[model samples]
Target: MLKVTPNPPVTEPASITDPTSPYECPDSKKFNEAAERALDYYLGPPTARIMAAPYCPNRLYMTNPKSSNESLLVDASETLGSANVMLNDFAALLEGTHRKTLLGIAQIVMLGELAVNQVLDNLVPTE
Candidate 1:
């Protein structure tokens, strides 16, 4: 009877047992240094090296650093008041949970405005 399958091809064993095999390096120190350099290049430093950007205020709408605290407080109060009014108007146009949420925010803004107004009232005018 004839065989359907052909005989397997013969092959040489791997050179792992040889002293100069590609698996073994003659200069281990150099190899280790190269590997470390490669790892450092790919993975970066062990510690974080993040560089923070220097603070530079926007020139277009930057607040004056020399502005009086009272003036700043007044501005803040006016902003909060406007925000509250806007929130109330928006809440009036909505219903359900969204309206309730907006109303709650408006109440908070109104409270903040009240606090600022109280501070303004307590502030003594400087000569």
Candidate 2:
């Protein structure tokens, strides 16, 4: 009778009975230290990073930090007034619902301007 499969190879058992742990190896300790360094490099410190000041995206038209509150209010009021006038002019050129919508926006801007002016009037000038 012929055999269908080959016989398995016989091998001798190890003379030493104890198996060594990977952590006990000198190369494994170096690998562990390298892994720790990589982790520390990728992940920053435990504490949250603090910013000195808030970041501003636009550098072109930034308000002066030293400008007085009254001056800032006046600038805002003037801008709102100009916007209201432009809206009204544009509204005059249109007809029907579009004109009404533009006029509504203009009225809101005018209200803002009036509120700012009132605040300015109430504000006492600082010497």
Candidate 3:
């Protein structure tokens, strides 16, 4: 049997510091402060407050705030089907290395299709 799926290489954890050696084994307080600062940087809201929208935007965009679950699922299914078909068609047109790359992308699309199909299947009861 041939293995098509890729497997990640196993890795062993590295020691941060040697016990016998000096240098205080790196201060936890400093590490905690750095980690806290990083968390604050990422999680903190925008520092610059935008009080109002642009007076005249080039293009206005709006999304459906009240999309139903069924409608969303149907849309997802249709989009997935279209994407899979387009990807397969696009992949067929490619040659050599590009073909393999596109095929890998198609595999990802197929996985998404599978996931969506599974959700739909579970949500809708069969007669």
Candidate 4:
């Protein structure tokens, strides 16, 4: 006969004995900081079934670009995914009812690029 295992009870304060690991409670800034993880939790992750998350959720792209199917390119896929999805078809989403968490990731990348440019600009100008 096959045996089934029962799940352990969850504890309020996580410790070695607790079934779940301790995690920081949601904070006001968590949305901006952990958008991707939040989206993965909600949208059930972009597995082989879902493909990729939008890289530019803010833009109304006619078509998105494709990235390599690799873990290293997961962040890159988010932006290209946005370009791939038809913006016209998701007018309601564009109106801003749903959170564009994936696009937020792309925006973060843009911000990082700006920072890098500033650093490079400073270095090149210095003799």
Q: At residue 49, what lDDT does model 3 achieve?
A: 26
What is the model-wide C-alpha lDDT for candidate 2?
0.83
Q: List candidate 3 segments past 4 Å from native.
A: 1-62
Better of 1 and 2 by lDDT: 2
User: What's the best-to-worst order under lDDT?
Assistant: 2, 1, 3, 4
Model 1 has a clash total of 0
Model 1 gets an lDDT of 0.82
Give the 10-residue window scoring lowest on summed lDDT in candidate 4. 67-76
What local distance difference test score does each model get?
A: 0.82, 0.83, 0.74, 0.50
* Candidate scoring better on TM-score of 2 and 3: 2
lDDT of 1 by residue, 100-125 (tens): 99999999999999999989878845
TM-score of 1: 0.53
Off by over 4 Å in 4: 1-99
Model 4 scores what on Cα lDDT?
0.50
Query: Which regions of candidate 2 deviate over 4 angstroms?
Result: 1-47, 51-58, 125-127
On the 0 to 100 scale, the lDDT of residue 3 in model 2 is 100
> Against the true structure, what is each candidate's TM-score?
0.53, 0.56, 0.51, 0.23
Tell me the lDDT of model 1 at 62: 79
Each candidate's clash count:
0, 0, 0, 6
Please state every model's RMSD to the true fold in angstroms: 15.2, 13.7, 23.5, 23.2
lDDT of 2 by residue, 1-127 (tens): 9999999976533323225544655676689989998887558664433253455579688889899989999999999999999999999999999999999999999999999999998895546
Task: Identify the candidate with maximal TM-score.
Answer: 2
